[model samples]
Target: MKISIITVCYNSATTIEKTILSVASQTYVNIEYIIVDGNSKDNTLEILKKHENKISKWISEPDKGLYDAMNKGVAMATGDLIGILNSDDTFHSNTVIEDIVNFHKKNDIEASVGNIVQHRENGKIVRLYSSKYWTPEKLTIGFMPPHPSIFFKAALFNKFGNYDLGFKIGADYELITRFFLRNKIVWEYSGITTTAMLVGGLSSSGTSSYKLITKEIQKALAMNGIAFSSFKIKMRFFWKIIGFLKK
Candidate 1:
C-alpha cells in the first residue's frame, strides 16, 4: 500500500534534517514524503534542497499556519494512507511505515493509530503516548489519539473533510472527534511506536498555551455538537500527567 507522509515546518533549521533523513531512511519504499514550509527564513530551504532526491515533493511558501500547510500537503498527497510528521519529530524506527502497511494488509482500516515517544532535545525519553486506552467516547473529555501516530485513509479527508481552519490549536482534536465520534470512522490500534516526537511543538508550549488549548478544546467539542464542559477539558490534563508518569 502506498503511504504519504507530510511534514509541516517553519524555520526548523535546527531539527528538520533529522526529520527528513528519518523519512528517507524508512524501510518502506512506496512512500511519498511531502513538506510544506512556511517560507522559512533560515537554512531549512537549503537543507530541503540538499536532500531533494529523498523527498517526493516540497513547497516553500507562506501558509495560514501549521494546519494550512498540512491541508496543502493533504491536497498534494496521492497515497492510499496519509500521515503527518512534524519537522521536529522523526519516525521511531525505519520499519514504522512498513509495520503500518503490514497491519492494514489484512483489512481496510479507515484510520490506524499507534504510539509515540516524546523526548527532550537532548534525547532524554519523556513518556510514551499510547493509543491502547483511547476510545471514541474519550472525545467527550478532550482525549485523542496521538496526532503524529495517526495514519488516515486518504479518502477520509475527501469524505469527512480536512483540518478545520477555524481552530488555532485544537484542529487535530476537532478532526479526531469528528472522525471517530461524529462520523464513526473505523479505526485500529497499530501497537507500533510511530514517531519520536520532540517535547516542544505546536501543542506543547507553556501554562498559558495549555489554558488556551483547553478553551479551544471546549470550543472544538461544542462546534461538533459533542457535549463537553470546561471541567472535562481540565480532566484531560490529569490524564496527561498520568501518561507522563507511566514510564
Candidate 2:
C-alpha cells in the first residue's frame, strides 16, 4: 500500500532537514513525501530545494494557519494512507512506515496509531506517548494519541472531513476525537514508536497554552455533542504527568 506523509512548516529551518531526512530514509518504498510551507522567511525554502529530490511534491505559499497548511498538503496527497509529521519531529526508525503498513494490513484496520518519544532540543527524552493507553472514551478527558504517530486511510478524511479551522492549538485533538469517537473509524495500535518529537511545539508549550487547549478541547466535545466535564478535562494533565514518570 502506498503511504503519503505530509510535513507542514513555517520558519522551521532549525530542524526541518532532520524531518526531511527521516522520511527520505524510510524503508517503505511506495511512499510519497510532501511538504507544505507557509511562505517561511528563513532558509527553510532553500533547504527544501536542497533536498528537492527527496520530496515528491512541495509548495511554498502563504496559508491561513497550521491546519490550513495541513489541509493543503492533504489535498496534494495521492497515496492510499496519509499521516502528518510535524517539522520538528522525525521517525523513530527507518522502518517506521514499513511497520505501520504491516500493522494496518495485518489487522485490517482503516487507521493506525503508534507511540512517540517527545524529547528536548538537546535530544533528552521527555515522555513516551503511547496509543496502547488511548481509547475513544478518553477524548472526554482531553487525551489523544500523538498526532505524528497516527495514520489513516485517505478515504477516512473524505468521510469525516478535515481539521476544524476554528481551533488553533486543539484542532488535531478535535479532529482525532471526531473521527475515532463520533464517526467510529476502525483503528488499532501499531506497537511501534513512530516519531521522536521535539519537546516544544504547538501543543507542547507551557501553562498558558495548556489552558487554551483545554478550553478548545471542551469546545470540541460540545461541538460533537459529547458529554464532558471540565474536571475530566483537567485530569488530562495528571495523565500527562504519569506519562512523564513512565518514560
Candidate 3:
C-alpha cells in the first residue's frame, strides 16, 4: 500500500532538514512525501529544494495557517494511506513506516497509532505517551493520541471530512473525535513507538493550552451529542490536573 506523509511548515529552517531526512530515510519504498509551506520567508524553501529529488511534491506559498496548508497537502496526496509529520518531529526509526505497513496488512484496520516521545528543545527526552488502546470514554476524560503518530486510510477522510478550519487550536482534536471517537473507526494500536516530537508545540504553549483544552472538551461534547454538566467539566479538569501531577 502506498503511504502519503505530509509535513506542513512555516519558517522552520532549524528543524526542517531533520524532518525531511527522517522521511527520506524510511525503509518503506511505496511512500510519497509532500511538504506544504505557508510562504516561509526563511531558508526553509531553499533547504527543501536541496532535497527536492527525494520529495515527491512540495509547494511554498501563502496560506491561512497550519490546518490550511495541511488541507492542501491532503488534497494533493494520491496515496492510499495518509499521515502528517510536523516539521519539528522525526520518526523514531528508519523502519517505522515499514512496520506500520506490515501491521496494516495483518489487521483490517482503518487507522493505526503508536507511542511518541516528547523531547525538549535541548534534545532531552521528557515524557513518553503511549497510544495503545483508545475509546470515546477515555477521550472524554481528556486523553488523546499524539496526532503525528496517527496513520489513517485516505478513504476515511472522504467518509468523515477534512480538519475543521473553524477551530484554531483544537481542530486536530475535533477531527480525532469525529472520525475515531464518534464514528468508531476500526483503529489498531501497534504499541511500538513511532515519532519523537519536540516539546514546545502549539497546543502545549502557555495560556493557549488551557484555552485549547476547554475548546476540545466543548467540541467533544457537541460532536458526541452528549450533555455535560459544569460539575462534570470541572471534574474533568481535576482529573487532568491529577494526570499531570502523576506524570
Give the clashing pairs for model 1. Answer: none
Point out where model 1 deviates above 4 Å.
239-247
- For 88-176, candidate 1 gives per-residue lDDT tens digits of 99999999999999988876689999999999989999888899988988888878889999989999999989999998988998899
Better of 1 and 3 by TM-score: 1
Runs in model 2 with CA error above 4 Å?
239-247
Candidate 2 lDDT over residue span 171-241, tens digit each: 99889988999888888888899999888788767999989999999999999989998997887878778
TM-score of each: 0.96, 0.96, 0.93
lDDT of 3 at 48: 98
Q: For candidate 3, give the lDDT of residue 6.
A: 94
Candidate lDDT (C-alpha), each:
0.91, 0.91, 0.86
Q: Backbone clashes per model, in order?
A: 0, 0, 0
